[model samples]
Target: MGLAAKMDAPRIDRGLDDIYVKETSICLVDGDRGRLVYRGFDIRDLAQHSNFEETVFILVHGRLPTREEYDMLRKGLAESRAITPDLVRLLRRMPPDAPPMDVLRTAVSYMSNFDPERDDPTRTANMRKAQRLVAKFPTIVAAHHRIREGKRPLAPNPRLGIAEDFLRMVTGKRPDPLSARIMDVALILHADHSMNASAFAAIVAASTLADLYSAIVAAIATLKGPLHGGANEAALRTMLLVGKPENAERYVLDTLANRGKIFGFGHRVYRTYDPRALILREYARQLSEKRGQEDLFRIAEILQEVTVRELKAKQIYPNVDFYSGLVYHLLGLPMDLFTPIFAVSRVSGWTAHVIEYWDDNRLVRPLDYYVGPRDAVYVPLDQRS
Candidate 1:
């Protein structure tokens, strides 16, 4: 007999799918309408008009920053972009073969020791630390990449904007206007999604009243999972493995035949196509054309077509991960750095959620319904023998 039949109770576990844990003003994810909103502003508007820094400001604060506030936030981020020498040395000493996400997780944890307000959970202190993490994560990711490649990490350029500076740090050259804008929009699109795994992890840790760094570390660790942030990396590699546009159909057929996942073709929440994917697909196409690498985009498109044709009946459509890999590649980033870039963008949203959760914080403890071997007596090793 099943547990439900024997115990007279139905199994209610669903991984908390479709469960609304709490209300949030930071973002609105309308999966049905294929829309995303941040602080009451449509993502489409923000992507077209706002930069990453400005979007982040809106997320952390409840409103768009005025020119004065914008300048202050920009200046603060620029000033905080330099990681400590000790942090650089520590990144250098870490196992050169460690996954970039693991390095990032460790770096955030290590940073806690250096925080003067590590024990202080005051709103001001948390906000200050959030600014620091937001500014420094990109630096940490770039430093780790350079260290693994036996190159000295570049210092952040205080004069450049966040997207431009991050591109420079990663590639040692200032990006052109189109590339910089693409990166900026990419960052804005990724800044937040309601109750995602990483944000949930951050919120759970913060609810325990842990330090901000610890909470972000929890977020990063959760993002490292393949099912979450790593999907884009997998999607890119899958496209590369297919090798040509002509091979995409075969690849999809074989994967489907074997019951393997097509990583970028579906999302848990979105009923239609993801709005971010819709935005990024255009950028991916334009960027690949600009870079004279249109063949890669062609293959991605063919695969997208096949995936949709095969699965549209089930509402399995492309998510942001589908085209974002191509965009990052066109931006001259290695696949391994993709999730770290995700972290760099998403730290803004993570910090915002953590800060907001503190207003009426509660521990996120859920009880499991036990139905296995209840009321059994304990057996000692000798008795068992």
Candidate 2:
């Protein structure tokens, strides 16, 4: 018998499906309609008309920012982009082959020690911490990449936006205008999705009145899991394994026949096409053309075509991870760094959710029905079976 049946309890939501924990105006994810809205603006509109800095303001403050507010936020992010010398030394001492996500998680936790407001939990202090996280996430990721390659980390250029500065630091040169714009749009697209696994993990930590850095450390660890933030990296590796466009069909059929997963093709929340995937698909195509990666794009196209043909009846569709890997690869990032880049974009949402949860915070304690045993009498160790 099932645990609930044996315990004579009501059926539990195994994954907490369709459960509402609290009200939030930060984002609306309409699975049925394939719409994603941040605050009050549609994601598509934001992707086209706004940059990551503007989008961060919306997610954090709950509305569009005035000119002065936008300028101040941009300035703060620019000022916060540089990691300290201690952090650089930490990065250098870490194992070169260590996973990027683990490095990110540890580095963030370490940097918490140096935050002037690390012990301060006021909304004002948390907001400053959020800004520092948003600004420094890229720097940490880029610096780790450089250190792993035995190179010195580059300093942030104050004149550049977050996206441009990240590309420049990682690559040791300025990015072309198109590439920089694409990176900015990518960051904007990924800024937030309401209460995703990583975001929820962050909320759970924050619910206990943990410091902002502690809560974010929880999020980074959660996002490191394969089913969460690692999908893009897995998806890209699958593409590379397929090796050519013509092999896409056979690979899809073989994987389906064995009941194996196609990493990027499905999502837990989205029933129809993922709006972010739809947005990135176009950018992927454009970047492919510009970077002479047409073959890679064609392979992705064929995989999507075959997967959709076989799985459309089951409501399985391409989600954001599908094209995001291709975009990151075409933009010159390595496969392993894909998820760290994801963290770089998603820290905005994670912090926003944590701050929102603290507005009317409660300890998130839930009960689990016990089914293992009924009041068994304890025995001394010598008499135990």
Candidate 3:
């Protein structure tokens, strides 16, 4: 009787099959098939040959920009590097303990207030917004860190590439060329992965006719939760807390015994491996070699090996987070700043998503099942008494 009654109720949870927006993109990922393509070209091809600005142009305009056009975009980026003084003052006023994601979420939303073209979503406007978002997000990130440390924010250097300029602004020194190149490739690799959590959130919000900033703010908020963008920070923290490679197996066992989910091992979408993870594993390894820090490298490698064996036995696999924290570590980012750095590059993809949604949007309203009493009424309290 109980089984029959349970079977009578409708399934309330949807796997949400419609969330992935299939576009005629050159960007493609066949996870189970272990394939990744971008702009009718493979990622490996792009990583070998293309830079971040080139990749960003590809994602935005659906074709590589010509040299003259690329130069114009670069100047537009540099010319727009500095944030308003008003924004700086507000950032300085924020509490030192505020999370960087929160700072970015709030600051980006606040950016709309100053823009005369904020309401325009025509192709021209979106193109401009895309450029502004990609250029300014790093500034916002660096300001949050510097103001909290009671240090002045450094200006973005026009001469530097995106990764080097970002590192220079945040760390107040230029990075080694190899380290910067690795970081740039990581950013390019991470720039898009169709309809992931944050992208979906932004699209759903945009479907409701929200402004670009509103859509982006909601997406950043979604990314702040542990199940999504926060996992990399969790990954870094897990490594730090474990403190040694020999302790990792015991730590995993204890964590599993406590029924705690390991941060970097499992993913929702991928079956065999995350393509981005493979890309970043190289960067992490390269950086460790360059810095002659074999211990850090060995610790990461052991953790990766142990995680792959245990998790595969449990039918799980390493996701982007697993390798990304190691890359960020090698690139000399503070643990706390890992996810904000993710935002710096992902803003390009997010802008692309919002633009796509605005072109052909419907309100993202879905039906819900009502489980309340069919016909219930309230009685006057005094009368009932």
Give per-model CA RMSD: 1.8, 1.8, 2.6
lDDT of each: 0.91, 0.92, 0.79
121-174 in candidate 1: lDDT tens per residue? 889888889899999989999989989988899999989888888998888888
Using TM-score, give the best candidate's number: 2
Query: What does the lDDT read for residue 43 in candidate 3?
Result: 73
Candidate 2 lDDT at 369 equals: 69
As for TM-score, the candidate ahead, 2 or 3, is 2
- TM per candidate comes to 0.95, 0.96, 0.91
lDDT per residue, candidate 3, 255-340, as tens digits?
77788887887666567877777887787778878887666667667777776776776667667887788778877788778888
Candidate 2 C-alpha lDDT tens digits along 1-385: 5765767786788878778888999999898899999998999999999999999999999999999999999999999999999999999989989999999999999999989899898988999999999999999999999999988899999899999999999999999998898899889988888888889889899999989999999999998888888888788888999999999999999999999988798777789999999999999999999988899999999999999999989899998998898899998999889889999999999999999999999999977866676768999999988
Segments of candidate 3 deviating more than 4 angstroms: 1-11, 15-26, 253-260, 313-315, 381-385
Identify the candidate with maximal lDDT: 2
Which stretch of 10 consecutive residues in model 1 shows the poorest summed lDDT? Answer: 1-10
